[model samples]
Target: MRASVTITGSLEDAFNEWTEGTARRLTDVTEQAASTMRDELRAAMSTAGLGKLGRALGHAGYPGGGNYSIHPAAEVFVRGRAASAAKWEGVIDAFNDGATIRSKRGWLAIPTKNCPKGSRGRFLTPDQVAERFGPLRSIAAGKSVLLFADVIAGKSGGVRKATAGRIAQGRESKLTLMFVLVKDATIRKRLDLDAVIRQWETRFPAMIADVLKDG
Candidate 1:
């Protein structure tokens, strides 16, 4: 995603000072927008129940082992000596953005093809899935299908374990809460671009004054 901020105001002398300062301050201003996007996206992912991946998101790294980037989207520009514009970029902000295929009967894996460009699947590792749904008690796993039984209550608050019974491997258990398809607009709502712009506008004058004072 990309967001552009354009500053508009009367061309008075005082305002000219601010606009000139804004042109020079484009980098810092765009950085602030990026910062806002980062924070907002993190919160949105958490709310969308993808907090694990969100925690791994970064600004300056290749996407692998859950690490992703949300760097600057485009170049900053000063248009006609009257407006200053900057674009902020984002990726990995979608919940239902990619496709995946199961590697095994239980393990959900990223397919080798038919995936969105620059996208990675958020499937758990085999070990993780085993941990959540205990490892097969049977020695022959591939011989038959497997399913998790209900959590049997432990006696006297002790830890529960598989009871001495035949675990009939007939069908595979489905992961109910595997992935959530949160809408793009739902994630965008948290960005609150208007608030970000308003904040920048509210502080631009003071920022320009400080620059002038220092100059």
Candidate 2:
């Protein structure tokens, strides 16, 4: 997925006029602006809690004069991501466009607090859980779920994963809720990518001036 900001129309003409009769090149200034916008977008992604996706941004363009036609009249563009970094695009798009996720197969297995964590403390997947305790015992409810043990082990609330030694010894053990089966899940529109682009878009001309001034 990608979002971009482009300078066109009077903006392009104004930049050309600003750089008239000088050693400054449009390509150089545009590259600087694109780089600056990429950095700003990356930072905003972090601020919006989409830091991983934010770092995926890549800016490209600013070819020679004749290349303008191929580039849609913009010297450069701040692109959100590339194909190599496409894994996190869905997440970014979901936050930007808002989404309702439904299971493509059957039920969505959402990890519960009682679910066992991996060595890194991340929640284990269904296959990993199955490796630990074989096929999960299903419980009958509105949305059916698979549990570690048939009976809800004697505990306060949440499900538990019984230890290997306890199960072998035939002793009562803690059983935690592994997963909650749900039909769908919702992601709200939290990140406004267009707003971010516009914010930096306004600063582009100033960036060009700054580059020329420094040069």
Candidate 3:
């Protein structure tokens, strides 16, 4: 779940010989790469069926004397959703990892009465589900999920604060899915860290070379 690449060689010596501005330039490059990585990771999760969690994904950076570190993570509110979040993660992993899910009770069904007339008899995409329930203005996912009847009866007041808080904070219910998606082969290839680091490796030398030339 974690990866890092260290660049070593005469490069360090060259950086040491250069001005402080050169070190700052290297840090800028690292921060930019980290930003891109975080964005791509969020995008990949959205496409991999974890879009709901993308809102909570964020990144930060720390600069030291000659290096910087980027941290991309879900915030405290997202971490608070461990229980139901785990259940959803299991469902996604079971499907992605090729583990079959069988239920004697039959597919967990949702009523289609809320769907648009044309969408009534078919499976609805997430967008369609959102549209069908748009009047509710929010979804619940902790101990209880927002149900059709709850929306109908306007009984979501109790969780309305929690729902609104999540929305305002841009946190999502199923965040573990983002972590799992990062490890997935297809997603990993698309966000390949090694390739990103290689590009940085090539650029680092050129950056120092440019600084030295200016000096």
- Clashing pairs in model 3? none
On the 0 to 100 scale, the lDDT of residue 157 in model 2 is: 56
Candidate 2 lDDT for residue 79? 43
Residues 79-173 of candidate 2 have per-residue lDDT tens digits of 44466445466777788889998889877888877676788978888778777656676676775665553223435654344666656767566
lDDT per residue for candidate 1 within 167-204, as digits (tens), equals 33332232222222211222332333345346655665
Once model 1 is optimally superposed onto the true structure by TM-score, how far is the C-alpha of residue 25 displaced, in angstroms? 2.1
Return the top candidate by TM-score. Answer: 2
* Candidate that beats the other on TM-score, 1 or 2, i.e. the better one: 2
For candidate 3, the TM-score is 0.32
Greater lDDT among 1 and 2 belongs to 2
Candidate 3 regions exceeding 4 Å error are: 1-17, 64-215
**Tens digit of per-residue lDDT, candidate 3, span 37-123:** 556555655776667654554544455444532221211112226796667545444433445444354323343444332435465
How well does candidate 2 match the true structure in TM-score terms? 0.61
Model 1 regions more than 4 Å off: 1-24, 60-94, 104-144, 148-152, 155-158, 162-215
